[model samples]
Target: SQFTLYADTSSRRPGFSKAAKPDLAVPLYEKFMARCRERGFQVEHGEFGADMQVDSRNDGPVTILFDTEGNL
Candidate 1:
């Protein structure tokens, strides 16, 4: 999965100012990926700010979208 943290509000051009800073986000991303690794899934990822390209295939036609207001 490609986790691109984004801002809450919409705009023609996105500015991820509301996204978690790397100090916070990186550790969480690492922990999540580690859990996936523990589940026996081979995983590979790029550095925090690297440009990445993903080529993937979906076996099932399921789509879900979520939005958050930053209120727990």
Candidate 2:
């Protein structure tokens, strides 16, 4: 069985700041489901979105973790 994952750092909605924009939900959902099919796993999908508005902003790199079978 094989699986594929897709991620995007940009959003579908426009006019919002990159840091505050909602992500491309449709593409993300499609890719996730497709990967489940390729892996022969029963499709279980979850998504979370946020627009964090923090005072006194600090610049830093963003990191995401996709846990597959308990492996980082």
Candidate 3:
């Protein structure tokens, strides 16, 4: 089993006075869940504050930690 972990940060929102915080987790989470289901891997969601976690796979898990408070 090949597992992988990824993280991304962005400040891109259109039609705004300034760059806004990105919706960093949703896309990644959806894709990760779909892939996990397709590949038949046991996927789990971490606790509220946990950054990332993985179990029984060659590649790690995908985790996105958003700093919503840092938006400017």
Candidate 4:
């Protein structure tokens, strides 16, 4: 209820290009969210492909993704 999610829709597998099929990624993400929900993590998000400016001010180290994207 207090956390945020900033999921990235950009999917790039080792053998795939930037032009590879993204058709499965969305569903996979949905399933992942479903599992998370099953485990009781309330989920929220932003515009899937939109650029965002983070305004966090935490002292702990933060983990960024390979796409330099954020997810919460």
**Which stretch of 10 consecutive residues in model 1 shows the poorest summed lDDT?**
63-72
Off by over 4 Å in 2: 1-23, 44-72
1-72: candidate 1 lDDT, tens digit per residue: 365757553434556787888899889989989999999999898787677787867778885344344333
Clashing pairs in 3: 3-59, 3-60
Write the residue-wise lDDT of candidate 2 on 1-72 in tens digits: 121233432444222233322357556666767988899988754434433444554467874544444443
Give per-model TM-scores.
0.61, 0.29, 0.31, 0.45
In terms of lDDT, the best-performing candidate is: 1
Candidate 3 per-residue lDDT, tens place, 1-72, comes to 122233233443323334222365456666767799899887775442344555654465785455545664
The candidate, 1 or 2, that scores higher on lDDT is 1
Off by over 4 Å in 4: 1-21, 61-72
RMSD of each: 5.0, 13.6, 11.4, 9.0
For model 4, residues 1-72, the per-residue Cα lDDT tens digits are 222243334555322234323375556666777889899999775554455776767677886555624343
Two-way lDDT contest, 1 vs 4, winner: 1
Task: Judge candidate 1 at residue 26 and give its lDDT.
Answer: 87
Q: Model-by-model lDDT, in order?
A: 0.72, 0.48, 0.50, 0.54
| TM-score of candidate 2 relative to the true fold | 0.29
